[model samples]
Target: MLRHEFHPGKLVAGLSLLTVAVVYAGDAGGAWEAPWFVALPLVMAGLLLAGVAATIHGIRPRGAARPEGGPQGSGKLGD
Candidate 1:
């Protein structure tokens, strides 16, 4: 039962797909316009941004030692 950190990368990646789906559904319902070419790059950028962010986020404290865990049932990741 560890308290997790917020992950912006995952959020961006997920939102990208969600945006695509919504736009596609809207177009199908004659409520929006979206070309595949534009959509493709947008999706690519989203994924790329997500990856880059994730990499950067992961790089922080990248080669350093982690802190010691607290007592048991302290709601941490590892002990």
Candidate 2:
């Protein structure tokens, strides 16, 4: 099995940008009507959420610290 890691903030930002592109494309192609007020606010909200997520993620420590003051290498998969 393979593991994947991603920053929630970056994901949100990227999705927001993609959505903005979609809105613009749709409007340009006359596929649907996207009011500037709604689209702009949606983009803004996405950016704001991303920024908040990034700030929270930045302040936290990386991976879990090893168990404290117990036994060495006891937590390994193989005993």
Candidate 3:
């Protein structure tokens, strides 16, 4: 098994999302608020952060590389 190095980008992205979540949670019931407002931002931020973290980790030296012609495989409609 290959061991991967810890990626600072991933850590930073995760921590940033966590910070955003905490901040939003704390101010969830302020005067300027609407249904799903807080939840939407939080979810979006979480997803963005997760994507950043995943990208960082996924590209690490020991991680799996994208298959030949890109993520969809062989660049073909039906492979």
lDDT of 2 at 74: 61
Worst 10 residues of 1 by lDDT: 63-72
Query: lDDT per prediction?
Result: 0.79, 0.80, 0.64
Global Cα lDDT for candidate 1: 0.79
Candidate 1 lDDT, 1-79, residue by residue in tens:
9988878899989999888888888988999777766679779988998998888777876334344443434546672
Q: Which stretches of candidate 2 lie over 4 Å from their true place?
A: 1-5, 56-74, 77-79
What CA root-mean-square deviation does each model show from the true structure?
Answer: 6.0, 5.0, 11.4
- Residue 60 C-alpha lDDT in model 2: 57
lDDT of each residue in 1-79, candidate 2, tens digit only = 7966558899999999888889989998999998877677878999999999888877755433345444655655775
Better of 1 and 3 by TM-score: 1
Q: What value does the lDDT take at residue 40 in candidate 2?
A: 77
- Clash pairs (backbone) in predicted model 1: none
lDDT, model 1, position 53: 85
Residues 1-79, candidate 3, lDDT per residue (tens digit)? 9977666666666676776666666667573434545566666776687677777666655325554587656777777
Give all TM-scores, in the order shown.
0.64, 0.60, 0.35
Arrange candidates by lDDT, highest first: which order? 2, 1, 3
